[model samples]
Target: MRARLGGLPTFVLLVGAAYCLFPVAWVVVAATKSTGELFSTTTLSVGTSLLANLGELGSYRDGVFWRWMANSALYAGLGALLSAALSGVTGYALAKYSFRGRALIFNGLLAGVLVPAVVLAIPQYLLLSKVGLTDTYLSVLVPGVISPYGIYLARVYAAASVPEDVVEAARTDGASELRILTSVALPMMVPGLVTVFLFQFVSIWNNFMLPYIMLGDDGKFPVTLGLYTMLKQGNTTPALYTLVVTGALVSVLPLIALFLTLQRYWRIDLLSGAVKA
Candidate 1:
């Protein structure tokens, strides 16, 4: 009887999956088409010009497309790593320690999470400009290193996942606080930190406004802004449409690779700090 009733839920899930994936499937198919075929062919039909499109994208603007990719990787990768590290240490402190101003600081960081990024970005740009830092890589990177949500997640995970008794035992064995955090607490927090990293990584990768407002050099533009400029230019130069489409298809691969690589950490039980057996 349960098996007989599973069809409706299965149908609903398949419908949801298709709704999410249809655009991706269209992009995969559309990127393969030539300029003429792109407008001429059915949305789902495969075309023969994938390599040609890729070649054109590579040659565009003195191969600046690849430069955009590298900048994105640098910004997102470095920013996420730093954000995760800072969040881990900060979260661990908030979770494990009791000290003066601790609650006040944690509450302030929580309030920061409620404020939208757009609200803060303009002020950040203006302040950085006053110091002569705008338009540089540091302008983008420095702002991304602090994630209130990451800190919040880190705090929650540390409180719930990290064993207090294990920390006490390490201290009793003459381990320094720094050593205990690095060697013991961090390992226990891996699954949660991976979550923080992915969140920050995707947030930084897809971030457009901060870089758009901060950096003037095309050399420093990440893929999001790069593709936006391409699409904007496509209105005058219709050929750029193909490059944008192809670039969109290529850009998603890194995120997919990241998800696949870090997915195993999610399977580890946060409470038990072990893989389900």
Candidate 2:
């Protein structure tokens, strides 16, 4: 019985792993091929044009790829930080405090999470344009900071991780509510907050529609939009395929590194949350 049960999970695990890694494998192999070999050769057969492809991509528009990467880092890093802070505060408040309209606020934030990014893109662009904020860094960063899902995660983390007795003791010792939140609760919530930050970081990093709509200038484009524009043009100029593939390879690196490094924190905190529940 044990062996059969174990084999069942192993088979499922292999299938799931293959489903996830198949695209990554395809991208890595396809990226090594030249334009002529792309459709001509087998999808997995690597061509000898990787270096030349990289060189051509580098020379394209005087190295626009790096600029887009930097812009993406700015948006994701700063935006995630702000999102984490807001989520921690708002989540803690909802979990710890009793007040009127709390359910209303929580429900509203939950609803906001279900709203698609494409739905807000045009309206956000128009609104920012009206205030002369369109085409600027603030236009992208500001909207990104207001993540509803982050708040929801933050509330869950705060409630699960933070002990009510600890909070009561801190209050009895005359710590201000803000101080209890900042020092006592914040430290306990670190793992969950990191999870929230990572999620928001990826979301904003992968986001294309909003930035594409908001910015007319190429300089301000995030990696996703920048790669997409290259892709769109690549349909006409198949040479841009090299840049698109190489850019995709580069863009995926940081996220992988981050997930590997921080995965332990997630596991540990997750176990803690589960025990509390």
Candidate 3:
């Protein structure tokens, strides 16, 4: 009876999956088409021009596409790792210690989550400019490093995962607060930290607007912004559409590969560190 009842939900889910997969399927198919065939042929029909498209994209703007990819990886990889560690530290401190203005700080960070990225971006851009940091990597990265949502998640995980008794025990053992945090608390926050890392990684990788505003040089563009610029130029030169499509396909591959490779850590049972084998 349960299986039978699940059929409708499963059917609905499959429909949603198909809706999501359609565009990816279309991109894979469309990227293989020549400029003329892109619109001439049935939208999903595969063509023989995939190799040509890949080559064109590889050759575009003196191989600037690849440079954009590298910049994105650097930004996302370094930024996310740093954000995760910071989140872990902030979370641990908030969870373990109850002190003056604790509630105020926690509430402020929580309130930050409600603020849209766009709302603060311009102000951040202005402030970074004032500090002589604009149009550099730091301009884009600095604002992103302070992820309120990450801190919130980290706080929740730290509170639930690291027991106060264990913390007190560490303290009683004459463990310095920093030492206790580094060795004792951080190890326990592994699962949650991994979640934060992946979240920030995807967010940074997919970000368009911040990098768009901060970086003046095409050399500094992330894959999203780079691809968008390519697609925009494709308006005047139809042949470039193939390159843009191919670039999009290539860009998603790394994200897919990364997720597939380390996805075990993403099981993310924050409430319990134990993962099913």
Per-model lDDT? 0.90, 0.86, 0.84
Worst 10 residues of 2 by lDDT: 268-277
Q: Report the C-alpha lDDT of model 2 over 139-258, residue by residue, as the tens digit.
A: 999999988878877877888989999999999999999899899999999988988898899888888888989999998999999889999998899878877997798789898888
Query: Which scores greater on TM-score, model 2 or model 3?
Result: 2
Q: Per-residue alpha-carbon lDDT of model 3 for 166-196, expressed as tens digits?
A: 9889999999999999999999999889989
TM-score to native of every candidate shown: 0.93, 0.92, 0.92
Q: Which regions of candidate 3 are displaced past 4 Å?
A: 264-277
Greater lDDT among 1 and 3 belongs to 1
> On residues 98-189, what C-alpha lDDT tens digit does candidate 1 reach at each position?
89999899889989988877788899989988999999999999889999888877887888788889999999999999999999999899
* Candidate 1 Cα outliers beyond 4 Å, as residue runs: 266-277
Q: What is candidate 1's local distance difference test score?
A: 0.90
Candidate 2 Cα outliers beyond 4 Å, as residue runs: 265-277
For candidate 3, the per-residue lDDT at 208 reads 85
Candidate 1: Cα lDDT at 39:
90
